[model samples]
Target: MNLTLRARRIAAIVLLGVAVTVTLLGVLLMIAAGTEDAAIEGHTGRADADVVSVTAGRTLVRFHTPDGGEHLPSVGVLYPDQLEEGQVVRVEYDTRNPDLVRVAGRGATLTILPVVTTLLAVWAVVSALVWWLRKPGPLHLRKLRPRRIAV
Candidate 1:
């Protein structure tokens, strides 16, 4: 095999492995995003929910949004260690649905994980194809001519 082909094969394998790892992480993050979405969609009667439980700065409670759905949400205000339980804090929820809620804002952060994983997956597939299609070395050998005798 040509040195180039060999090196490329190794690289392709590494990229494929990285792609799989990234895909797994993406799956986990996607799940987290869905869970967060669900949490905020629960309360519908009021503008915001009251903090029901607080150990420190963090609180757990059900929030009321414009949509009129309900959910039990656990959120950290300043931090779980700093805020008191039952402290009322303004939280954002889904506009279309009321039950979904969050302590801070929408869980848009989780979207990046899947996007990066998808990019890695595409890169891995392309690299594997390139490595597979590569043709190394010459197809045939050239013949050498005979040398003339010296005087």
Candidate 2:
């Protein structure tokens, strides 16, 4: 095989490896989301929380438990979509672990669309790249023969 062809094959293999890793990570994210939802449902507590701040990754809130203790979950709320700063919203949390909270009515199912879309996008790009790399090129590029030298 020509050196260029070999290099292309190696690149394709590396990209396939990356795609597999990404897929695994996406699956793990879904599983983690489901686990959190189950935990919150098992020991559920409801509160009207004040949305302290909203960022791309998290929505910070402050809520008071029945015991008059206030909680500001360090990692923020789960499934915190469309929340705005200073807005009051209903939240469900784990009484056993106050830090585990989520926006009321939202569950792990919300994560399915985003995770599946990301995986599909990644695989689409990877498939295209691998196909281009593995496809045969011009006849001359397929193989290179070394010149014979008279001894």
Inter-residue clash pairs, candidate 2: none
Best candidate (score: TM-score): 2
Task: Report every candidate's CA lDDT.
Answer: 0.58, 0.94
* Best candidate (score: lDDT): 2
Cα-based TM-score, every candidate: 0.37, 0.88
**Tens digit of per-residue lDDT, candidate 2, span 23-68:** 9999999999999999999999999999998988788999999999
Positional deviation of residue 89's Cα in model 2 after best superposition, in angstroms: 0.4
- Supply the global lDDT for candidate 1: 0.58
